[model samples]
Target: MQTVVQAAAWAQTLGLPRLEAQVLLLHALGRAPHDRAWLLAHSDDALDTAVQATFATNTQRRLNTEPVAYITGQKEFFGLTLHVDHRVLDPRADTETLVEWALSCLADTPSPEVVDLGTGSGAIALALKHSRPDAQVCAVDASADALSVASANAKRLALPVDFHHGSWLAPLNGCTFDAIVSNPPYVASDDAHLAALKHEPLSALASGVDGLDDIRTIVRQAAQHLKPNGWLLLEHGYDQSHAVQTLLGNQGFVNVQSRPDLAGILRCTGGQWPTVK
Candidate 1:
């Protein structure tokens, strides 16, 4: 029988990153993924035969490019532990840039109304609600399956984010929000990156030819749903900031600009609806 350390070492031998190997092993051992210190303390503890087998299986899943969060069935985003699966796109840390931006925009407004469009796992909406409990947060998704996953996260986290099922900005007609945020699919349908992301839901990864279809739709519809002086923030492809800024400008949004992610890439862009006219 392999020991805890041995199992982790064995998976790394198969080309898995050290972090991925440790997470998978911890998962197989029924331990918290973040419990790396436990692994070191029990490094020499022998794994049960069943646990070793499970570790090997999870190792192969990683080799196949499956996301570690999906295998472990949870991911930590914006200081929250969220349950995730293939039914929804795995939440990325970079998307937190958009959430932070939204929070900053709403900081001065008491009990601000906010909506997260394309809330795959309700990460954005939930994070906003957790940070600003007084804020009224709503989330919308086009896929019912996605909504199920998002809502479950909300229920588990005890964050009362209102969820709606419909295309972007469609379900809440006649309702206006202080801010609207989204991380819509911005990958070109023909982009080679899709091959690496095959494990994720296709509809959540790709847009039209230029990959701006969903962004265009949201920018067009957001004006109608946003309160005067409200903000519309979006997480988009690495190189699409200029195009996104232009779209927002054409929509008559003011204060258009982009924010860099942790890596300093302009990964999110936003603008404010004019308070006048």
Candidate 2:
């Protein structure tokens, strides 16, 4: 005797974000996630017992602070619907800043070779491959489970990307890329925000105490792997631009610059690896 209208109203009473509640409800009802307008048009429609039970379960999960993307098992990033779960961190729209900057760096180069380090869900690598089919794309990650998720995404999207199983820049011996990018773990070990991200894999969300451990690793090693004039783009915490820019400069990167995200926060930093350096 449960109805979609009643369920939606109950969700509102719980103070759940309208979009998250509807997404969970629609997923429970086996409807498309984008069909929010459909729900509005048919709000009065009744749902069967089984559908109601399923929706209730999802609503409770959301109430417990589970991410809507994790509940739905999919996140849209850079025009691609990426399947995500606990095995990988949910791709964030903010990370698209790195992808956009990477594309700009490779715009004039023909058949540019690109590598995404610590590619959690293959989001960055796949988006680069999808947008520039002529470019050769490679994704490297240390977690086998994460690699499996990313590999599946690449296959499902029919995007050809070389998948490597190892830590950042480890497996690509003697291989150089025209552009290297990553949205590595930039959250500090003591950052208060880690509590909110409890469900995500910590290895993919936190680095050393300063949160720049991995960035240091990537910047230090990039000089050897990057072709002359190659670019390295990374997404970091909003307040770490100055620190990251200094790291890039210390590593011999020139024309270093930080790009502002949609919120005007300098969330991404990049620089060119000059041949003379």
Candidate 3:
């Protein structure tokens, strides 16, 4: 009979990081993943046979290249605990930077309208709604399955974001927003890093040959959807900052700029649509 401490340590041997092991173990015990301190305090507590079996299954899933967030079915982003699964790309801490930038753009505007394209799991839209309750938030996705997951998240979180199911900007035809933001598919189709992320949905991970295909589509269409002087922000590949900056400039966006993520990598770029003369 293995105790909580022993089971967690053994899980680490399965090639999981220490924190992943602890969080999964805590989840199996019906404890919160962030309650690692509780696990330490109850170190000697013996896991029941059923609990051990569940943890073993979760360990095997992790070893099979499944993401820890998917195994646990929850990811914390922007201080919001979001429900995530295989239907959408998992949210990352890096995305919080885009959300912060969007919030800053809306700071002076009362009840600004914001739209998140390719919302995936509704991480960005929900975060913005949670932060600025006065903002009218909307999220759009191409996959109906992904939209289902995002809608469920909104319902559970009580953050009322209008969910639309269609390609980027398609569902919101003729609708203009005060700001538009997205963390679109920016990974190149042939990127080697994709091998490590084989478990995520391919459509949510890869774009076209140069990984800027979707970004190009967004830049072209965003001009019509963004109100004059409205800001458009996008999270993109770390190395594609220059390409993205040029794309925005070519699209007639003024004040074009790129922002570095938490690690100082230029990860998000944005610009403003001009006031129509």
Candidate 4:
């Protein structure tokens, strides 16, 4: 048994960054900050082994450029904690911008049907369903492994979302929605980020040479699945806003616009499908 302060100090002595050390200690103790004393009083050699294992895994993965989410097997998005692993893309806080925008768009629509394309870890779909219990939310992913992880998360959160294992809109054939949102693979194959992204599944990150391949496909096909005046929102690379806006405009979307993230980067682009003429 050890105190929280002692465990934190031990982690720091192991060369972990301050935040990582604290987080690992919290996880190892199986106790929240308030339960620190209880955990410390009952800690044993098994607890020490578990803490050391976590520290070694995180440190080695970080050294190898593996994302912390992949190492920790979890990430927080839209104020909800999600289980994550190599099978799915780690949910980023930036993607919450899309969720917030979607919520606003659906505010006046009764029981809006929303579809999340590429629903890794079910972050977007599950979060939306959690917030709007009446909404009919469905998520699709090309990877069955990713969908399995997403399904587990949905069940864990008690959010009822339809999960489909298929690429893009294949599973949504003849299905229409009031809104369609995606945080698709928009990284260019040759981008320097790929060097660091190698730890992630290639299909989950890189698109085509221009990085707009998946974006282009989604824009092209989204109209077929959207109800009249439906909204389509996407999170993209910081530099792809103009191109995305053009793509949306060319596809007859109206009010095409890009929203800046917390960093002021134009990270999300959206537009409305034209109302029937």
Best by TM-score: 1
**lDDT per prediction?**
0.94, 0.92, 0.93, 0.85
Q: Which numbered prediction scores highest in lDDT against the true structure?
A: 1
* Candidate 2 structure quality by residue, lDDT tens digits, 39-139: 88888888998988888888888888888888989999999999999999989898888888899889999999999999989999999999999999999
Each prediction's TM-score versus the true structure: 0.99, 0.98, 0.98, 0.88
**Alpha-carbon error at 191 in model 4, in Å?**
1.2
Candidate 2 residue runs with Cα over 4 Å from true position: none
**Candidate 2 RMSD to the correct structure:** 1.0
Cα lDDT tens digits, model 3, 143-231, are 99899999999999999999998889889999999999999999998999988886899999899989999999999999999988899
lDDT of 4 by residue, 160-266 (tens): 99999888988889999999999999999998978866678889989999999999999999989999989999999989999999999999999899988889999
Rank by lDDT, highest first: 1, 3, 2, 4
The lDDT of model 1 is 0.94
Candidate with the larger lDDT of 1 and 2 = 1
Model 1 per-residue lDDT tens digits across residues 34-146:
99999999999999999998988889998999999999999999999999999999999999999899989998999999999999999999999999999999999999999
